[model samples]
Target: MKVSMGVHQLKMEGPYLTALRESNDIREDAAALQARMEEDGYIFIRGFHDRNQVQQARSEILNQLHQSGRLAPDADPEAGLVGPDNKSAFLGGTNTDKPAFLELVNSPRVMNFFTNYLGGAAATYDYKWLRAIATGGSTDAHYDIVYMGRGTPNLYTLWTPVGDTPIEMGTLAILLGSHRWEHVRSTYGQMDVDRDRTEGSFSRDPLELIEKYGGRWATSDFEAGDAIFFGMFTMHSSTVNVTNRIRISCDTRYQLASEPVDGRWIGKKPRAHETALEAPLKTMAEAKKEWGLA
Candidate 1:
């Protein structure tokens, strides 16, 4: 099977792309889980959360969107079809305080998993990156470190699909073993999206990375209870949403509670990266040229 990732068609079985390996079997074994994470850079868990809880969260979120006139008035609220004139389909860093969302993210099931995985109490960022991607919407390839690496290097990102997300609805794809790319870590990984005042994405073209760095892109048909967890340096991007139904998901950060947290995402009102376009933004091309990777 072939899927589209930011205009690039990738075969699901090849050096180009493949299915993510599920680690649910060893979820309770911390040592093995850590070793697997070190080897794969990510752990895709099926049914990590309660399916009913996830569905409730999804319903709440969709209702909020409907009330805001973001969803099509003619469609069922559960369908999550975006309105024709809703230009702001991407709802990142907004609606973090919704009750259902808070419960889902901070639920004992999620928090306990992180705590056990990290071998200590876990702390999650207050800011939740909730996205409601519409048809034609897609995210570019990039490392999470570039956006939130100001604190502990051990920080991990947990991406959860709020609803059933098939390939057509778009879901995150990870570059297998990318966390160990030394050159990239020493160069692109060191970048801070806020400090540099540049676009966060490393490349809009997913094929560029595969040609330069030998690794296959991996993803799966994500269900409501499924989640993917990876460290800061992992490279990932989402497939384009080809269907009319909105693709809802959330990505949140977690790390040992004892470690220093990124100040930008801690407060009741996280002063998330100052994205006001005050100056001419630096392009990833320019950064790559300076780093001699161009």
Candidate 2:
């Protein structure tokens, strides 16, 4: 199959792109699930949640986005048509907590799955991400850790399909077994999204990554109940939305409750990267007067 990934139009018929291994049965076997997570760096579960319930949440979010003037008025809310010239609509850092969205993340199915899979209490970051990706655009390749590894490295991200997200609707793809790649982890994995050069993604071109490094990119057609879970360092990116409808999805982090979570992502109004930067820092000279530490 020919695919559009980043700047390249590459043929996927070769050994380059593969479908993720199925682990929905891991829902019943927690130990097996964690083992899979450790082995593959990701587990894509098809229909892990109830589709009807997921659709309800999808409707609520699309309704809100449409009300916010992000969706096309003439298109059905479920259709996810973007406003004229929207090009892209992202609410990753600035999206606030809402009753519908809050309910979606806090769904019993989600909590139950991780609570058991993690073998302990599970808590998610309050800063949930929602993206209304339009046609011709896709997420740049990056590891989750670069953005949120300040706390427990054990944290995992659950990428949920807000609605029925087919491949044409632009679902995500993971670079096969990236977490265990010592070089990528020791180098790119150690990089921070907030610090250093600050561009979190490793590369936008999938072919270039394979040519320089070496790992296949894997993805699948996603349904509303489908969920993909991966560790903080797992490298993943989205396929372009070839269809006209907006590709709606939400991704949030999960970890054992006892584990420390980054302070910026845990509150009602997440401060995110500018949490401290928005405020001017006190210079050493000024600090001498206040702290007597000069």
Say which candidate scores most in lDDT.
Answer: 1
Specify the poorest-scoring 10-residue window by lDDT in model 1.
Answer: 86-95
Q: For candidate 1, what is the TM-score?
A: 0.96
Over 4 Å off, model 2: 93-97, 275-294
RMSD of 2: 7.2
- lDDT for each residue of candidate 1 in 1-294, tens digit (9 for 90 to 100): 779888777788866889999998999999999999999999999999999889999999899888888789989999888788754355556365478887888899999999999999999898888888878888888999988888999999999999999987899999987898999999999988778877778989888898898788888899889999999899999888888888899998899999988898888788888763657889889999999889
Summing lDDT over every window of 10 consecutive residues in candidate 2, give the lowest-scoring window: 285-294
Candidate 2 residue-wise lDDT at 61: 75
lDDT value for model 1: 0.87
Q: What tens digits encode model 2's per-residue C-alpha lDDT throughout 75-167? A: 887778877876677777535445666676777878888899888999888888877787787988888887787899999998987888887
